[model samples]
Target: MTPPLAVDIDGTLTRQDKSIDPRVFDVLRAWADEAPVIIATGKAFPYPVGLCEFLGIPLRAIAENGGVVYVEEAGEVVYNGDPDAAWAVAEAFEQEGYDLGWGPADMVNRWRETEVAVSLDRPGDRLRELAAREGQEVVDTGYAYHVKSPSVNKGTGLVSAADGLGLDPEEFVAVGDSENDAEVFTVAGESFAVANADEHARAAADHVLDASFADGFLAVAESFGIATQ
Candidate 1:
């Protein structure tokens, strides 16, 4: 049987500009035929849902770095993080004269529900301190600094999502490229880190591919006899 997948977006399927590698679309669709292909990312809600639509996959997503999990086929939406706690951290950042740093519009986090995303340009150490003061934790996703509850993470989200899908979380294979992806490495039956993965993620993974980005995803799929590298 083909294995299910929990995959990260940015730095895994996307380029530096954040555009997805088109080659992955066909590959993911093929994988979806046999098992679920979950788009798990630090990106806000609509993104993963929208990508699911575009990818023509009913399996769906784990968005906001595991703060939100949408199992479209199961029609279940799970919220693992505390939105109030995230808001408190965001408020604390503003009080300390540190904006979310996404400019006036801040579209990066506009649709976010359970976590506050801060730009990498801000002082991470200071942000961590502020989040800690609010009884929250700050996680660096390699894309941004996310202030959220310490309890909720990709691993927990995967467990919830898997239950909704009527599958064992340990049966899934995970692929990612950063610090935020580390927890998922533990829950998955196997984990692969792209060559471009963060140091933390690399250490957490069972396999580290020589290829980077979408190519690395193909490598993982290929190793499973599912797709071409």
Candidate 2:
């Protein structure tokens, strides 16, 4: 039987700017044609759709952690778990005095130099600083400060997406680079951490890429017995 593969986008398949190395597509397309390829990521928008188109596969995608699972066959989205409470909590904090900004996909992101105080009146810039200082505090997808539902994370999303496809979660191999990807790595049959990944990501991965992004992805695909070198 063909194995299921769960892949991360940022810092694993693409560069910091989200640029994909030409070779990434070559390997990915080949692999997708060989097996079912599922994209598990924090991006909640239509971005994953482009990837599905690129791969020429019609599986499912888990976006915004596990908050939204998009099934291609059904052409619809399902919420794996409710993040209403988490959203309310984040909004309450924002109202109370936090400088939190909402991310594109509703995730929370803080800066690396601000204090860790959750206040409603906090300035947006200051909140970014706080996120930076907190480093791993839930941050937004891009430059926003939206916090995702506490229970909604990538790992949970992966499981949900896998189940939706009627595949064993343990049959997947994942690759990622941030705190959000930690659980995915732990849950996957094989996990790869890119060279530029954070400390937590590296620790959870079964292998570390000597190269970053495209190079790393190519190396990983080769390691998995995929067609790309």
Candidate 3:
């Protein structure tokens, strides 16, 4: 069997407005019918799981930038790091008046299981400094800054999920459009970055698409000879 396709959710699968393109959804649904389609994203577990529910697809998801994995067959989420450690770091930042919140806009400071996401406006350098001091890891997802453990990331989470499913890492393709996705690009045998991807992400990818968002994802699927119908 072809290895599953792991894709980032926000900028790669949806538009800036957080809306899924109908055409893209159509292709995704069709693709899911033939092979596993894993949702790899920086969002919390529920967010991507919610998307899968909305699409009526029984696909697994990697959330919190690899901090959590939701295995569809298991119907449970597996956490990669210590949630208390992440919260401790968040608390320390909060005491410093950092105004830490979950994500951007309405989702700001949303609660997560294994990681904490703060609005991107916060100083990235400070966050990194603090994380280093606490022996933690920080990654910018373009939408938010996530604090997690060094052991976990999109790459590790993707590998964990694929291994659990008995899929070969080299058979999978990863697609994304942000700095946090750089690690994912490194782990997958084939990686693609959308036109809107950050320079770092593009550099890490095996292919860079001219189109943005879902269009770019569709282009990637076509290039891999994956049927969109």
For each candidate, what TM-score against the reference? 0.96, 0.74, 0.90
C-alpha RMSD for every candidate: 1.2, 6.6, 2.3
Q: What digit string (tens of lDDT, one per residue) describes model 1 on residues 1-229?
A: 8899999999898776778988888888889998888998988989989888988888578988889998976787888788888888788779988899899999988999999999999999988987888778999988899998999889888988998889999999999999989999999999999999999999999999999988898888887777653
Tens-digit lDDT string for candidate 2 (1-229): 4467788776777866777666687777777876777777666546676777866777567666656777665566777543444344445556666534343542323221111213333354544443334332454333223345455567777777777667767888888777667888888888888888888888989988898876787787887688775
Report the lDDT of model 1 for residue 9: 91
Pairing residues by index, what is the TM-score of model 2?
0.74
TM-score of candidate 3 against the unseen true structure: 0.90
Q: What is the lDDT of residue 210 in candidate 1?
A: 99
Q: Over all chains combined, what TM-score does candidate 1 have? A: 0.96
Which numbered prediction scores highest in lDDT against the true structure? 1
lDDT digits (tens) for residues 96-214 of candidate 3: 88777533453644547888887778877888887887778888777888888988889998888887677866677899999888888999889999999999899999989999988
Task: Give the clash count for model 2.
Answer: 29
Model 3 RMSD to the real structure? 2.3
